[model samples]
Target chain A: MIIKNSIEGSFHLTGGDFTNAGIASSELKSILTELGLDDNVIRRAAIATFEAEMNVIIHAIAGTIYYSIMPEHIKIIVNDMGPGIEDIELAMQEGYSTAPDWVREMGWGAGMGLPNMKKNSDEFKIDSVVGEGTTVEIIINIKQGLR
Target chain B: MNIHEIASKLSLDVKTTKGDLEREVTGCYISDLLSDVMANGKEGDIWITHQTHPNIVAVAILKNLSGVIITNKRVPEEDTLKRAEAEHLTIMTGQAPTFEIAGMLYHFLRC
Candidate 1:
C-alpha cells in the first residue's frame, strides 16, 4: 500500500529475548527509507530504537516500540514492563548502567545506551516510575525542503 | 585489503551469498559486545568477534556493516548464518583467536 501523506508503524518486543531485539528497528528503518525520510534522520531514529529495544530485552521482561513517520519529523516511543528507573538523571548519565555481569560482558551496560539515544535524537524525553515501568520518547526533525 | 583478499589470505571459509563478496569493505572492528559494536562500528566495516549468535547479525543489520567474522574457531548459530546469507551479509569463520584475528585485520588494513 502506498502511503502518500504519512506513515505509522509499531514493533512489539519481548523481554529477555536477546535474539529478536533489533528486528523491529531494522524493519522500521526500511519502512522509513521507503517513505522517503532522510538517511541521517533514519539512522538517528534507528539508533534510538535499537538502544530502547535492547534495554527492554536486557532489563525489562517485555515492552513495545511505537513509531510514526511524518514528512517533517519522526517520532519513536518505547514502553517496558519492569522496575522503572529510580533516578532519571543518573540513568541519563553516560556510564551508569545497571545491567548484570553477563549483559556487561556482552559489551553493553557501558552506561551509554540512554545517552546515546539522547545524542542521536533531536527531541528526547523520558517518564518512569520506581515500580511501574519506563517510557521514552524520541523525535528527529526531518530537514525541510530536502529530497 | 578488500574482503576477497582477506578471505584468501587467511584461508577463511566464507558463508556469504554471491553478492556480498563484491561489496566494498572499508575497515573492521573487533568487539564481543553487540552494544559496543553498534555504537562504534561504521557502515561498510567488518565486525570481528567471538560471540556467535543471532544478535550479532542483528547488530550487523542495524549498522549496515560490510560483514562479520567470528573468530577462534567459533561458528555462528545455524539460524544466524542462514539469516546472514539470506540478508546478503558477508560472513566468515577463522581459527585464530579474537586478539590474533584483530591483529591480522589491523595489519591488513595498515598495509
Candidate 2:
C-alpha cells in the first residue's frame, strides 16, 4: 500500500533492540506536533505507534514502520517478520499475551499492546500468517478543537 | 501544583537535573503496565510506577506527561536516566510504595 501524502517516513526496528524501541513513536509524535495537530489526536497516534513499535521489538526479528500525514488523517503501518499469531481474535483480547517472562519483567508484555492500539485508534486492522509475519495498520482522523 | 511543589510536598528525591521542575501537574496515574498508562494517562499528569526502564521515559514523552515518580526507592537504570535527561523528563525517586505515593498524590492534587 502506498500513501501519496506530502509527508511520509519509515523507521526500521530490530527485534530485541529494547533500548531503541520507542524512537519511532517519538519521531512520529514530533511530526504530528509539527503539523499542529490536536493534542488528543496526537496522543492517540503516539500511543498506537508506541504499542506497534513495542510489538515489533518483542516479537519480530526485524520490521519497518511507515507513517503518512495526510490532509484529513494520519496513518501508520507496521510490518514485522516474526512468528505470526495463530489466532488473531485471541491476540486482540485484552490480558492475552505470549511474551516471555523476561519481556514481562521489562514492564511490557501485559497483553495490552494490541487492545490498547485498537482503542486509541479510529480504525485498526491486523493481518498475519503463522511463521511468516504480521502487519498492523492504524488510522486516526483529524478533527478541530476535539481535545 | 507543579512538579517542584509536588516533590517538595511528598518529599520525593529528585533524580535528574535536566527536566522542567516547574511543569504543572494536572493529575496522576499509577501503573507499571505501559499499555495502561498509554490508554488512560493524560497529558501533564504525574506517572507513578515501579518499572524503571527507558521505555517509561518514552511513554512519559509520548503522553506529554509532566513527570515520573519511581516508587519503593527503586533507582532508574543508567540508560533510563540518560534517555530521561535527553527528553528533559522529570524523574523522581520515592521510598514509599506505589499505593502510598498514589494516595498522597491523589489527596494533594484533589484537595
Candidate 3:
C-alpha cells in the first residue's frame, strides 16, 4: 500500500455510471477522515469533491477530479469536456439549473452543486470557455500539524 | 425514540429487516437528495427521504445515518433494500408523504 498520507490523487469519472457517481468522493472522504481530519473539515472537502463529481455526470459526459493533500491544505481540480458554461455568473446562481427533467427526477440538478462547492471550500475558482470545457479548482485549508 | 416506537407511532411498515427496527435513533434529517443528506445528516440520524435508490444506502453508510424511512408510500428497489440490510441500516416505509413523516419525527424527537 502507498503510505502517502499527504498524497495527491486523481479520479476519472465516466459519465455513464450514475449508480457509481459519488463512490470516488466517498472513498476519498474515508481516507481523509481516517487520517484524523476534523469532521467539519472532512464534510467540507467531501461536499466540494462530491458536488464536482456529480456535475461531471449530470452535465458533462466525462471529467476528471484531482486532489492534492498537504499538511495545511487540500486542493482539488475538476475538469470536464461537457457543454461549457456560457455565462459563469448565471451558472453560479443558486436555484438556476440547466439539468434536464430526468436528472431532476433523480433528486439532483437543484442548481446547488456549484454554489454548495463554493460555500464549503475555503478558496474556489472556475474557468470556462464556451463550446470548450469547464475547470474548477477548490482549496481547503487544514489546520497546521494535522496529518 | 427507538425506531420501532417511531414505526408504531407513524403506523409505518417495516419494509426491510425486522431486526433493524430496534436500533436507536439520535436525530433526523429530511431530504430527497443524497448529496444534501450526506452533507448535512449526522450519524445516528433517521433519514426521511422520498428516494428509493441504492445510492441512498451508500449515502447512509457514508454519513453514518442510523436508518432510512422511505415516505410517500414508495417502496425501495429490491437491491436497495438488500443493500440496507447488508449494511445493518434500518429501512421502513410509511404511508404519509415526506413532509408528514418529517413532522412526526420532529415531534417524537422533541418529546
* Candidate 3: stretches off by over 4 Å: A1-5, A144-147, B18-23, B35-40
Please give, for residues A70-122, the per-residue lDDT of candidate 3 as tens digits: 77788999999888899889999988899898888777888888998999899
Pick the winner on DockQ between candidates 1 and 2.
2
Lowest lDDT 10-mer window, candidate 2 chain B? B97-106
| Residue B50 of model 3, lDDT score | 84
Which ranges of candidate 2 are over 4 A from the true structure? A1-5, A143-147
TM-score rank order: 2, 1, 3
lDDT of 3 at A134: 92
| lDDT value, candidate 2, whole model | 0.90
Q: Per-residue lDDT of A1-147 in model 2, one digit per residue for the tens?
A: 222465888999999999997899999888877777788888889889999999999999999999888767888999999999999999999999999998998889999999999998889999999999999999898845233
lDDT of each: 0.82, 0.90, 0.83
- Model 3 docking category: medium
Docking class of 1: medium
Leading candidate by DockQ: 2
Model 1 regions lying over 4 Å from their true place:
A1-4, B16-19
Which ranking of candidates, highest lDDT first? Answer: 2, 3, 1
The residue-level lDDT of candidate 3 at B108 comes to 87
DockQ values, each candidate: 0.59, 0.85, 0.53
TM-score of chain A for the candidates in order shown: 0.94, 0.94, 0.92
